[model samples]
Target: MIDMIQQFASCCRAAGLRISTSEILDCFRHLQLIDISDEMQFKTTLRTNFIKNYREQGKFDQLYHLFFHELRTDIEIARSTPLGSLVKDVLENLNQNPTDNPSKSILDFLSGDPIGFLEEIRSIQSEGNEPMQGPIKGPRSNLGSLARRLKIMLQIYAVQESIMNFLAENKSKVSWETNKNLKTYFSQRLDRARRYLHEDPPAYPDNSSHVTSYEKYLTQLGERNFASLTPKEVDEMRIVIAHWVRKLKDTIGLRYSRNNRGIIDVKQTLRDTMKYYGVPLKISYRKRPKRKGKIVTLCDVSGSVWSAARFMLNMLYSLQECFAKVRSFVFVAEMDEVTRIFENNDINEAIDKALKEANISYNADTDYGSAFRNFKRSYMDALNKKTTLIIIGDGRSNYTNPEEDIFDEMREKCRRVVWLNPEPKVFWYTGDSEMRTYEVYCHQIRVCGNLNQLMDFINDLVL
Candidate 1:
């Protein structure tokens, strides 16, 4: 029972609970003070001993049931049966007569044929009894001690099996499906990926063939081509790459927009005042007025570029932490401002609303020309030298008129016209893609396929 309590405490600690030695000792003391005759009283004592917060009460209850709740029939039989003999029998039955019935559930095995199970448990106890050979008067049987130890062991086995079953049933809920060690590895990888996306980019391997000590095992996997890698390995690599890209973006802040007005440029301010060295500083300060900038994102949410659009939306959502004024627009055949949708806290809900508002269909063909023309006609006044315009799309017009005039007008009106194309540079003029024709009007044209490329493009924007 003492060992059982200690093990349960350990499990709670592993599950992010803060459990101290003092708490464990206090629990044991409380258990001794409480009457064991009443099950409810015993449970209350246990809860009072270990649980310090109401929030943790439910967690404690789960642990208690997992660790100490014995099979009712086992307890009844153990009370009457010779514990040593019963343990030996149970061990023999488990080893020699292991059940081959695949149809039986774990719960059934634990609860079914309780009398036979208890007898087998008692047999295991008997096998462990050793004769006393020291100053003891005679061979003494530590039957109660053996029984308690057996109980703890059984409880551990039951808990382990239960956890396995729970994991098997809930595998789909997890991001990665792998062995225990791999699952832990994937979780760490995910954490690293998220960190990279939001923080400064880390150094990449200088040499591809000369694998770093950290990823030596991964490099040794006999994979000659990226396509040949297993799905699990590919997913793992993708996560790592995604993290690297995210970190890169963090290191290189958005380049298109000017810094916020709240941030004072002491050096620039002082330089401007240098012309009035002998004059009043107030006059110079008045001459150099502070200016705020606006960020306008025009994302192509058409069927051709849905993946890239989703990624851009995610980045825009994350950018809310850095910027104050941000407006978003999604375009398929037409464009609609989705700033309010993005302003909502829930990203999934926001995206759904944005898609609905834009009437974006996954099957619809892209018409960047019409979308640009519509935006120019409806919101031309919104464009100014203070506004930074970011357009994310594949630059594919699906044989529609390129509408280069609208982009030309946009470049003249906006402070910057940045075009982010998901397709490679070679695909700019191929097929119905009008990227080559559209590229001439934009201040910067960047290839943004994956998160890394997108991060680099964003970094370049603020520069």
Candidate 2:
């Protein structure tokens, strides 16, 4: 039990949680006072000792779940039994000639220890890209980390196939029940590994404490990251957002109406004074421009970013009258204009349809450069000096060309380029992210990881 706890602590540390030696010792000391078999008490004790702040809670929870539940290799079969021997034999055969660290680590994980596999994943997640040099003019991406991950995934697939083949060959030797258990065991392990590899790390809370009075109602769910929201939370979010949109529309309408008189025109006022025998009988106010603001948004709908983007689009369309026009495009690897979808259908229905029926491939690798290039080619005419180009994405281009040149051109063509990144500031420049490269061209860049931040951006846009 102590060994398992210690190993779990090590895994937590590897996953970027600050688990100190003193804390581990304190956790052990406290564990002696409680019944360790009580899972709730056990988890609470560990979390209380290890988690330093609210920001670390999400990461700590993920690590704890992974180590305790996902990585447990608890097969009911006894080692003396034929099923156990077959399991051991299969692992031994796969491990006889280990090809690489990742494969070896995977096999070790299946064999009941996941410390090495966890470390491998940590290394990949934390790998930094090399600095850009003279000619490229952008960050030089290193696909070495991505390649390593792909290799690990392929190794998992190979292991799964090998396990199935071994079971097929030995089906007659073992009972049907034993074969079924063995297959289920290995399948679960491999699938967990695959899921852990594919999933993005939980977003750390934003460190900046820019509190606003508007976020008073948004006590809990408003601060929660969009990607971390459950289905119920999402439904709650939609309700809150609908109320917010209505409030904003009323507020903007009143504000615009209050300012209908526009600014005083000094020359016009003086000219009218001359007509009144040099005594100002009346003052003249310049007419406010009748043209409304126009917005063009390029939203990245690839997995994680999509969670935030949909809400942003919903708000933009719900308050569509605030702008003369709101043209939206969704993209994964390629751009697809979904402006018509929103125009024809109800806001929520449009958002759902856009997600499902957009002409881009969601499964394709995220290539921001490709998407930007496609947009420039097909929709360059959509932008004018009156248009504000808002881009909602994490800026992860997957080591592809960022095509900053085209972005620069788009900047010149539009009134302003505002980027709303769902990722925290700390992760902006890491891995395959091209945020640093594209940052120069943006007129404004905000971390819109939660409802408050998104609401703040929309408020600024409308008012």
Candidate 3:
């Protein structure tokens, strides 16, 4: 029973739940006090020992369902006449073909050890998006994980077909009552596997609050995803953004004021003391410490997450004084410096010009792999230990190579990496999103689609 509990903890950890050794030990000690045959008490004991908070409970419950119910041993199915031998024969036939991951995982699911199937499901849910090989064709989708699930679903159907065919050929081998119960039990198990393919673990808040503490009036447009806003709403957003820029500036100024003052200048203090006949008079501090850190921004204006880039650019340039130098790059398939655009134009015009004439192929598919490669090849020198690299995107690389090595290299070259994903947290690992891939190297990941998220991020940065 303790071994079984430990195995369950292992499954939970594989599913991205943070189960610790101490928690498992606690679970072990607690289970000894409970009636193991009572399923509710058993589940409650495990849940109480492992799950720490409400947000994590959704994932915890899913893991529990997959572990206990879907993966339960089929002792009932095995006991009925020749059915056990029949199931073994069918599974042997299915395994005759060279098995891929989909086949292997489903086969594991049927044998009452759902660990392999659970692990595969976890991978699909957390799978990072990368480009699939082909032309820049029509409407593209990141269907790699989805496609794999469909294949497994077909395999499950095929197994049922094989079972039906076997029963027709050997009806005399098993009695009617045994056959009926056996088929029903296996059918229920297969249905459980089908449900696993469609199960959604949990989703974080999508369109949450628009009201920031600083905003006096409730902002209607602030809540909208930037890329989806209309022209009129865009104008309103600019007004709201101006206020944010000013507030960020004030906040930054306050930080510099409080933190950057240097050591006392003894020479200047003594010079002033002469006016008071050698008595200490006015004391003077040395100049403020140099704000020499660099901030490098890689904005994905891939049209999918367009609004985020415009406002993010507006914010970065407005608070340009916060850093010694600010470098901005925009990319879809390629990246190019757009600091000159902002340098020459007003904030609004610069943003418009960046979208229109930054020399990026706006029509091209987003290839984060290629973008990261280009950044490493061309602009790696711009990064230093004093640099903070901020990436703004949906992290959807259009099913292309993720090039996570380049990303990690850049991470090592900088003080920190911040990924501001405009996509809702729910959609992050879905489709072509490389959010999960890049998240490993990021110091922070924030949902930045709405103005509230943007405001919150800036508040963290400056306040």
Candidate 4:
């Protein structure tokens, strides 16, 4: 029971609840006040003691069902019936086995009959006799032991079938129902599975520690090394990543400067104008119009860089509020402006459309030269001395023509050109990556991989 409590607490943590050993102890103390024999009383006591929020309550309910739900004895018996006999008989004759077999077997054993099948098997084993091969194990073993093992196997199969059915039925709603941590875990697992099936074989992690929470065990089904991570640890990672994403975008532009000589004080201007309004021939200085800032985002939505593209899109969407003008473009084979998508506040829809319109073949090929040339021709009028051209890509053009001249032309038009590459600087010149070719033309180039790197890059951009 103590182990069960601890397991429940761990599940709560995975569901984004913060639980400690002390809390589990407190729950035990509360359980003492309830009737131990009453299932409902025990459940009520735990819920009242442990769950404090709606989210925790939902998690508690799921854990409770998984732990307490038991299959009926009849169902267990039916499932444990020899698989070979069941399948052959049912498929060939389309007939059900006589239900009296189990009852008669139980009655014969209970009647103290010396002719019982189990007794006969034990007699043979006791005489060092080897039983013939069969689907069901020899009856020399205790029926109770066999039943327990068979029940566990059947339960596992049932749970797996349930999971598949749930996933198939709730494909769209799964995203909404599952928390971010679980989603990340599942997505990573699916990716690993695909990679294992199609690419290089994945190394399995050692499963030495048998004692782990259910969530951790589930994660291990996807990744062996991932078995040690608790739900709390996964949630912590999600929270940390979310914080970094917000911080990175916040730092990605020029800080508002109070000391800009170009910005006129309206109150001071009005005061100066009032002094000259009342009399003789006096001239008043005209107020200067604020200088509008220009922002040009060139993001790579190519197959190889989709993850980075998503993160960059999120950053740019946030930046739309701070900038005067944001011209967003996605590139693969060519560049297409997607500023309107951001304008409408439909980021997911916009990304879907952008991916379709860009027609960038995933992992196929990248033509930076063609993308830049197309951008220059289409949006040349929008480029000016005030414009900041921000390019986000891995810089892997598949050894295609980089067209450094287009970048030079872009540098001539924009105030500053900043290249944000997701790949590490070490890989900049490796393989077919063309980052080195275009790096020379950009005014600023930074490696923006994880959120920490991105935040540092953004801080530099703004400063």
Q: Which candidate is the best by lDDT?
A: 2
TM-scores, in order shown? 0.42, 0.49, 0.52, 0.42
**Per-residue lDDT for 132-183 in model 3, tens only?**
4477744436487788777778988876766566666667877887677657
Top candidate, metric TM-score: 3
Instruction: Choose 3 or 4, whichever is better by lDDT.
Output: 3
Q: What is the lDDT of every predicted structure here?
A: 0.59, 0.86, 0.79, 0.57
What stretches of model 3 exceed 4 Å from their correct place?
A: 1-217, 258-261, 290-292
The residue-by-residue lDDT of candidate 1 on 1-463, one tens digit each, is 7875676666556433577899889888888887877889878876776666655665566545534653333444445655323333333333343342221222232322222323333344444454656788565577754665445445434534443454456566443433353234223423332232223222333454554654665444322233245657645654554564477556544332334334455566677677788343632222223234667888887754655665566656655544446788888778778877777657656766776665555456778888888888887777788888888888887899878988889889888888888777887888988887987888888877655576566555443
Q: Kindly list the per-residue Cα lDDT of model 4 for residues 5-100, writing each as its tens digit.
A: 665565455434566778788888888777878988988877776766554565466445533442122223335654323222322221122321
Clashing residue pairs for model 3:
130-399, 130-400, 131-399, 131-400, 132-399
Q: What's the C-alpha lDDT at position 368 in model 4?
A: 83
lDDT of the structure predicted as candidate 2: 0.86
lDDT of 2 by residue, 208-309 (tens): 454453345456789999999999888888898899999997897677667687899999899898877999789778878655789999999997999999
